[model samples]
Target: MMLSAQNLTLARGGVPVIAGLDFTLAAGQALILRGPNGAGKTTLLRTIAGLQAPVSGTISGADDAIAYAGHADGIKAMLSVRENLQFWAQVFGGGAIDAALDAYALHPLADRLAGTLSAGQKRRLGLSRLLVTGCPVWVLDEPTVSLDVDAVAMFAAAVRAHLASGGAALIATHIDLSIDAEVLDIKPFRAKPVHFSGASDEAFL
Candidate 1:
């Protein structure tokens, strides 16, 4: 498997949110996380991406092979689109950024400062970084936010291509990308409220 989480218990702000969560993703496959607002989907993705620690359990096969994109677009506003991609490529030990530029149709804006682009354009640039990461596992959170219809299609196409190239994806998104993927509902894994019996336990809570 490319990524697997067994009996994972995730937390936000030191309080458990989801418990006993288990999932796996192999090469050429994708998994979508489903839950309502404040359902800990972001927390779960964060843990898998190594941004934060899980309260408990094991996440295997996600050490250096994962590329993560969270709610924020991880880009340098002062850098041009091409420059930004080059930086990430160098950081991830990837190759040329030409393919990434073409993937998002950013050839025209390659030299434009990332801060000068519109919301959708910036989002595309951010998504384009995935192509330059050279990682086999992708972990994304609300990847389609601020994207137009065409931009969304572009993102979906990129994901499809990644899977075809023997990569895996774990995404927490509400929009359906029309790709072949399994859905995992986290509502069932909601953490139960812990009753405090003493002052020390209350302090921990």
Candidate 2:
């Protein structure tokens, strides 16, 4: 298994959000998280990415193999597109920056400053980090947030190529992607309600 969660419980701000969740992702497979706002999707992804710890249970097979991408672009504003990619490739131990640029159609914009790109272009740059990481498992949150249809398609193709090379991915998004993946709805694992003792009835008002 590339990633596995067994009876996992996650929390945010000392409040439980996901509980008793169990899932597994294998090589060449993808899992898509589907949920409404405040449904613990980001929380779950963070836990899986090791950015935060789970409240209970255990997660296995998701240690150093994961490459995480969150809502933020995580790119330096003053750097050129190629510079950004090269920097990450070096940090992650020298990956194929040229391939990454080509994958996202960033070759034409290689010399352009990252700060000057549009939101969609910046998002593509952010995603290119995943390629440089060379990690087998991808953990992404809202990866397609600022992308256009063609860009989304490009991302989907990249994901497909990764999976074809025996990699796996875990993604959280509201829109449909172009890959075949198992859908996991987090509603069933919502945390149990907690009761608080408060003197003021106006708190609810």
Candidate 3:
């Protein structure tokens, strides 16, 4: 599979935040997005996730083949670890929570409420959703935001495994993630304001 963006432009409240962005990623490959705050890192990811409509240009190759994990982790506060996994399994298509939990070292907290878990724990839970589906592309924004060193390593390991298994990923992160990936610097095209409505792509480009 291949992911591409052509002269992508985006606006929020009618203000430009990203302009003329373009790139492509191949299966078993990864792209790292780097930029300062307000640089449209998250917006870019959202756009590729098909949750945000660009104001101009086009984002191609984002469809049923992708999985998006936003910065928030998307964990249900009211649910326990297991419950959360069960819910995501239903959405992403059921996968083994026991194995995923074990992989993320969350087995001990499987019965605990997601609201009670630490920030890193929540990120792990949210990322584990990747394993619940067979989607070929992944869009992750600041996936290691609150993770510790070991956890970060674990995260990289899992993502590497995913790529090795023939998947692609677009990651927006500030911390240095020591993984082999094509780097795309978005500072030059940083548009201000960054608008997103989680609507149809037709409304934007």
Candidate 4:
């Protein structure tokens, strides 16, 4: 298994969000998390990426092997597209910036300042960082936000190529990504409140 979670639980700000969840991802596979807003999808992805700890349970096969991208683009606005990619490539232990630029169709924007790109173009630049990371697993949250139809298609193709090379991905998004993936609805695991209707405060001493 490239990544596996067993009896996992997660919380945000002292409120339980997901509980007793289990899932597994292997090489060349994609798992799409489907849920409404406030459904803990982002939390789950964050936990798997090791940005935060799970409230309970265990996760295996994710140590030092994940590249995570959240809602924020994380790109420096003043840097050119190629400069941004080059910086990340070095930070992630070096990679082919040319390939990453080509992967996200960023060649034309390579010399353009990141601050000047449109929202969709900036999103594509943000995503190109994943390629430079060279990790086997990708943990993404709302990765396609602000992308046009053609850009979405480009991202889908990039994912397909990644999987073909024995990589895996875990994505959380509400929109259709146009890729073959196992869908996981996270609603069933959402936490429910415990009620104490009509019970006295000292009933149990």
Backbone clash count, each prediction separately: 0, 0, 5, 0
- lDDT (10s digit) by residue, model 4, range 85-142: 9999999897679888888889988999999999999999999899999899999999
Span of ten consecutive residues with least summed lDDT in model 2 = 193-202
Report lDDT per candidate: 0.94, 0.93, 0.85, 0.92
Taking the tens digit of each residue's C-alpha lDDT, what string does model 2 give over 62-155?
A: 8789999999999999999999999999988976698899889999999999999999999999999999998999999999998999999989
TM-score of each: 0.95, 0.95, 0.88, 0.93
Error of 1 at 120 (Å): 1.0
- What is the model-wide C-alpha lDDT for candidate 1? 0.94
| Candidate 1 stretches greater than 4 Å from native | 197-205
**lDDT string, candidate 3, 1-205, tens digits:** 4788999998755678889988998989989999888777878888888887998997777778888989778889999999998898888777677867866898899999999998889988988878777788988998888889988988898889889988999998867778889889999998654356768655878
How far in Å is the alpha carbon of 74 misplaced in model 2?
Answer: 0.7
Pull out the clashing pairs in model 1.
none
lDDT of candidate model 2 versus the reference: 0.93
Local error of candidate 1 at 199, Å? Answer: 5.9
The RMSD of every model to the true structure, in order and in angstroms, is 1.8, 2.0, 6.5, 3.2
**Model 2: colliding residue pairs:** none
